[model samples]
Target: MMAMVTMVAFALEGYVNFVGMTLIERSANDKESAAASWCDYERKGTRDKVKDLRRMTGAEIDWNKRPYATIKELNELRNMFAHPKPQKPKVREWEAVGTDAEFRKQLRDYRPEYEERLTWEFCTRAYDDVEAIWQHLLEVAKINPFDALSGGSQGFELLAWVDENGRETRA
Candidate 1:
């Protein structure tokens, strides 16, 4: 579950960087300037990077809404897992149970709030949030989501044609 959450977060980060760089290349006057601009952009926080992309592409994403809000939570969850600190578990008082012949004492260890966040539902939701954000950006950029490298199950394919003259061209 931790792995899924972390991967989803990292994938979202990579996707934003990819989209941001593409936008920079398209808008900048020169390759050198684009490269330098990208260097500065890469240093910004994840939220800032997303905001930059939204501004560049005219995407009106409400930061307080579903998928967007999920992004913030996902980042926090990723950070918690990435830089985990040792924590003392809350141990409950021992309780006696059963008859004297089978008597046993049990103690419960309380889980931390961060640990509680690692649920299967959360992992699935995080994955869905990433897909939603990716699709939204792709729509604003006027790029076909189906042609995207991460586009679902259709996979990716390249085709080329060769004429009788032996010259090859991509279809």
Candidate 2:
């Protein structure tokens, strides 16, 4: 569970930073300012990036399906796991195991908003939300994320992949 949350957090960071950089590069500013500005904004948290993306795309979107809401929920769960305020005696970490009811009861005093256990199902939904936001931002930016790795467009490799067996693969 910790691993999932950690990975999700990092993945969202990388994605949001990439999007920020892409947006800066697309702007009329010179290359140096664009690069520097992207780095500057990239220091912000993932939630901030989500808000930025929403603002950037809000004019085009109908507000029918609010992607940031899901992202915010996922962010809350991530925070709950990452920095749990444990109320139970000597319970040092978030309960990565046990039934939802048991976990809730254990955290009842600590985090009352943890209505559901951070199960694989919850992670799956979070992952889907992340993907949805990624797609939406890519569409709004008119940027094909794959293009960054495909055509030497960015002048160097920006992405790589690893198979289940741990073999490295270029994008």
Candidate 3:
């Protein structure tokens, strides 16, 4: 569950950065890479991306405002689950057992109280918070997320108006 939330959060961060790059390129009329190559080279993280987004879009994306606020707590929990230090031996054990409880001993390591804390309701709430932030971003970017013709259970043709020599015309 922690892994799922972490993955979603990271993906959202990447998407936000990509949108920032797109806005910057479009506004400047520079047909360069849509994503920030400089930031990537420098290994800039999500906070840097958020700053870039704010600068490029001129929108105050107060992550502490609404749905995004939960992200900080979510990240903290994710880190705790991922890299539980020796100082918190119980947390480490919980993480290890939850990750893979193949053995009876591993299963026994997890207490009933821990199970109560890490319930289905808790997991879903965390996921919903991440999803809410994603939805908010989509709205801010004015991106229409759905295209019936593009994505579904059934696959569609890859071609986009093929010409005489099998050349593709997008517009």
Candidate 4:
């Protein structure tokens, strides 16, 4: 039972960090995207379309137009999970494993959130939220040109180094 509890806690932390890492990487893409669009508008020379694009995009999207702030926050959250955060404790690190009262206090002080045994339902919800953010990042990165052509669901796709023409090039 203790092992199960420990596993679940670590899983939760991992999922959170996974989502956070994606978000952080996405922030870079956001900047890239804004740069792409500047060329788009510059070439198209359509005032109405440019106005429409601004309207369609979020307010946070500045002249370059990307959610850099949100991405930065997500990266920080990921780093917090990736390192041994003294502020949070894993289930296996319970103070009961030690005889000293100091250890017990340390455990409780760190993982104060787990007032009860962490449940699947709780973990599932957290995972779901992480998934949503990840999906959004994929959409923004435009990982799949086929999806762009088809106008289908913009799921996450990775791009390798590309030739000047934007075709996927060999490493």
Number of the top candidate by TM-score? 1
Residue range 1-171, candidate 4, lDDT tens digits: 233334434443443333333333444457676556444444531223323333443322332322222323233433444453666344463335566887768655664433343455544443454445334433544344343234565676665889899988765
**Candidate 1 lDDT, 127-151, residue by residue in tens:** 9989899888888877665556664
TM-score of 1: 0.74
The residue-by-residue lDDT of candidate 3 on 46-146, one tens digit each, is: 55665666665566566766556665655555565666755433543334443344665775655643344555666676677666755665566655555
Give the Cα lDDT of each candidate.
0.83, 0.68, 0.58, 0.42
Q: In model 2, what are the clashing residue pairs, if there are any?
A: none
Model 3: weakest 10-residue lDDT segment is 147-156
lDDT of 2 by residue, 55-158 (tens): 75553543335555555666677777778886444535764588888887776656334644567877776677677777777888777767646354555565
Against the hidden reference, what TM-scores do the models get? 0.74, 0.59, 0.52, 0.25
Off by over 4 Å in 1: 85-108, 150-171
**Cα error of candidate 3 at position 59, Å:** 3.2
lDDT for residue 103 in candidate 2, whole number 0-100: 81
**TM-score of model 3 relative to the true fold?**
0.52
Can you rank all candidates by TM-score, best first?
A: 1, 2, 3, 4
- How much is the lDDT of residue 133 in candidate 4? 38
**Residue runs of model 4 more than 4 Å from their true location after superposition:** 1-112, 145-171
